[model samples]
Target: MKKTFQYVDYLWDEAKAAELGDDQVALFLYRSNILGADLRITNYGGGNTSCKTIEKDPLTNEEVEVMWVKGSGGDIGTLTRKGIAGLYTERLRNLKNVYGGLEDEDRMVGLFNHCIYDLDSKAPSIDTPLHGLLPFKHIDHLHPDALIAVAAAKDSEQVTKEIWGDTMGWVPWQRPGFDLGLQLEKCLNENPGIRGIVLGSHGLFTWGDTSYECYVNSLEVIEMASEYIEKKIKENGEVFGGQKIEALPAEERKEKAAELMPLLRGLASSENQMIGHFTDSDTVLQYINSNDLERLAPMGTSCPDHFLRTKIQPLILTLDPSDEVIDTEATLKKLEPSFEQYREEYLQYYENHKHANSPAMRDPNPVIIIYPGVGMFSFAKNKQTTRVASEFYVNAINVMRGAEAISEYTSLPRQEAFDIEYWLLEEAKLQRMPAEKPLSRKVAIVTGAAGGIGKAIADKLVAEGANVVLTDISQENLEEALATYKRDEAAIALCDVTKEESIEKAYKEANLAFGGVDIVVHSAGLAISKSLPDTTLKDWELLQNVLVKGQFLMAQKGVEIMRKQGLGGDIVNIASKNGLVSGPNNVGYGTAKAAQQHMTRLLAAELGGDHIRVNTVNPDGVIVGSKIWEGDWAEGRAKAHGIKVEDLPAHYAKRNLLNEIILPEDIANGVFACVGILEKSTGNTINVDGGMANAFVR
Candidate 1:
């Protein structure tokens, strides 16, 4: 079902109690709607918006209303009192002008002091001052389908100019929030009185004195562009119907699928497109199943936003729209040049619009959907962007329904879209977070850390400046893990990971050790020793209890602590190597690992909406006289292989191409990477397998 999007008037009604003079409240409400729209209009939080307001002290007769902007995670549709905070506009503007920019912490404190309600909430939006600099009262930001359709096309700027005239000013896509806002401020100062802003390869933004005015401006810009594209499409929709044919058998189908995937993958710079994010979706099945495949082939991708999503075009299954034959090889050959031309044009566009010293180029196979007979498929960097682009294409198709409509839709020019897609300023936005001074003060809980990978991860995390709580099922092993770390830097807790009561107590103890728990890594898991044929129900249940059930309980408790602290947190799950790429000999262990991996992904998707990052790591092998791999079991396994127990680690390491034995430290580093202590890779997984497997399964 389509999610509802609110208008500026709806926001106006919500803030009626605040009165016009309560501009701070008004500003907060407005900012909330912008965030809401960003969330509702797309999948995930693909877009963001903000507002600025002044704050005053009722007492002292002194005041600086400043700019009360939306706090991070403050969704527009449901923004509340604490979601918006006060920021000093003059301070921000001054900082931007300084030789070196102000730190995120200082800027956060500047805004934090201005919050009217809770001080515990995250700092104001990174784009606080960017909104402050806008001359308009209301701003509307979105990755509009109509606009993206034009933005990523071959002559998008020309199309944009023809459609909007001098009324709109276009900016290359920059990472949104602060950096985009700063760049926008620069643009506004240069352009003077431009009515709206078009971010090539990104989205559209329009503003006015009121929400209605801004909304109308946004609609007008999109409507004009859509109308122009519609006219151009009418001139060439049915130029060719092409030729037609018949269907193939099941074995032939699988063979054809294998053949087409490689070609499509070859079109991509990496193995990403063929094994892209959408291979598992129903849409992929539908595209591949379509009988009249070539009917959709000649048309361009739905829109520019889709370039990163559905790709430049879907792979046509046959030469004629009515053909039922799934001639995958023939279809790929016919579509080859269009793909090559698309890449060339994309690069040229980037070069034309970019400065000499810009960041390196991104891949050019923006979108590559597959069609098996009549079925279709698509993918993108994130789930949300992919959905929006897909829907936009469907919408554009419907708009031209039955009107001699074939290839009516056009994407923004490749060069213009390329410029926006590869814009360095935008890339920088991904790294532009408010300085996390308080994050350093936060504490984390890593479960199952009695030894092995858990202990290694905890040590690495502490060294980078975070108080850590190491927990395990064994009291002696827990103490052993504690001994490996500095007493002042870490604490140890004993708890059976399989029990909720034990996890709850561990959370309480960890919370008491530090002021609050800000990060949780559930690494304790049991691996079944038997093969699937030898595995019993009890063994399966035990693995599920320790790996799957324990993770759930720990995550539940971790969220409660994070929520109470009013500061979001991170949760990392240590899944096994079998989870992502295989159905190994241990049935129970493999099943549990797979479930845990997916659970981590689902958690990240849900919790990310709350500004919390949820992710997982899949460690291949790290056996070093550890409890899980020690004693009789290790010795017996070693004897079976005709090697001493002490030689097992070396033997396993030699099996991998890198011949690098993965230490618990490597696993620990993977966890930190997920927590973004290293970089911002959320809802992802890293395999510490030393190059064991390189297939694209997940």
Candidate 2:
């Protein structure tokens, strides 16, 4: 770690701090940014900073000493004034006198709530007492990988003495709580003139009267540890036999991930509901492909901080690097049994530690999966959690490697890890999460998702908490569409629906991304208006290839994967009003859509034995945001109605009995109703045309 403080930026922040009226908050924000900006110092949401200041109580009209700590659940990198919780310091310190010694963690939280200086302030961090008990005006706590590397070694105390001499204090492993706060206070009283304290198997804490002092103290300590590790590596050989192994090309690795990820996603999932994210970054690949991976990967988390995100041990799967190509089916056969074995081991671990009132064991599945020669696969209940687990595991790899360079890397004993894993403070966070949406844990595929109706369907599915795979013939449009929604929950695939190879590849990629598909919305179609006498063979063939043949291929492939998983699924085909009630110059488009509508009925009948439901959404006059109804198509429709092109929308709206202008969102609503709200009603057609009597089938 190099020093990242810039003199000019510091001066600018100082000047800006004076204008904010609260110098402590402004300085805290600045220093927190500087600390969080360096990944070497902290990973995502892993560190905290605080400042002690004075504020006037609105009700009392008197100045009160307060501690403004980083709020719980806020990331330090993007912290704002609202992200700091203000508490009455004198009152908060007085809680120790009234401590009943019952439900300490819960009582600590309640007492912190009672001591808030501002009623509207956010919740205080659980580690607030750790800062309040210290005498300094500013405090910094971080899980710097370098510090953890030194602190987690077998001879951690000796390493600490060598690196910091008498300037730092060492506290043994203790779960963060009121008790830990008391322990820290005792340590500070015993070790005079110490600049900071290193919490064994946890993190680093430093404090000062000014923000600059606290920030610089943390930097210097971490820098010293980094230098020590670097020297040890130079004296000894590379950590864990750091021999460079040749990796497959990037494209080949990506292909291998695509092939293997689906099987892992299926096997690692608890009840086939978990979503997976694959990562093959150079650092992760370097560690997983190393010769010592079998021994090192199973050695537990570098620190207890990660136990909440990642379990104690990662599941290791050995791969045959000699086989150049991946056979997905054969791989699944091997992984299926291994997944069962992992679950059994995990249950046994839980049984060994369970007491009368331990929290229910979190799904008995591994959060991190190590695939030798491939990379890492991180699994979670959703996409964001999966990404977080991946980040922590990456940091774990670095910390462990650094420790191996100096001494053998050892983690907290398994019992200590289990205690933290079941700690009520951590479990409460999960309990407070919002209820999942209707389609949570389900995966969907939306064809022709570049724009208009297809894009609308994808957005709606994501809003209801489904992982969607958006496919279109145009890559640019597909990417733009994905960017509009939750990007993590949506993926893009450039697919030409007219080709069998393209359709197959798209489904395979979707399976790799989110295990398998549970819903298919076939919205990719083309509308070409031509009279019977004027229609050519090429126009007819084009319509059939995309509108009719494409749906067949998509349904066939989607149902195959759904059947293999034995999960009931839904398929909705986007047809047209012209299919049921034909107008002049609608020979090609109408015939193809009519065939598609019949195909939906046939599929519903044939697949009902497997509990698969198929339906059709026939929407007419969806002129707004419709790419298919623009340019010549709009002009032609206007000509048929004896009106100007711009007035065609008004004319069509008036044509319906309800006189309502149908939008793409209206069509999306119908599709959503079919797949989600109307779960029991399938093998039916729902028309979204604002009551077109002529096209009514009932």
Instruction: Output the number of the lDDT-best candidate.
Output: 2
* Candidate 2 residue-wise lDDT, 18-43, digit = tens: 66555778888888886877777776
Off by over 4 Å in 1: 1-46, 57-62, 68-87, 90-130, 146-356, 360-367, 379-415, 429-698
Q: Candidate 1's residue-wise lDDT over 173-271, tens digit each?
A: 443444566678787877777887777555677776654455556656666665665676567543223213223554444334333333343354232
Task: Report the C-alpha displacement of residue 580, candidate 1, in angstroms.
Answer: 28
Error of 1 at 91 (Å): 5.6
The count of residue-pair clashes in candidate 1 stands at 48
Question: Tell me, what's the RMSD of every candidate?
Answer: 17.6, 3.2
Off by over 4 Å in 2: 1-22, 100-103, 242-247, 319-329, 504-516, 560-568, 609-611
CA lDDT of 320 in candidate 1?
A: 39
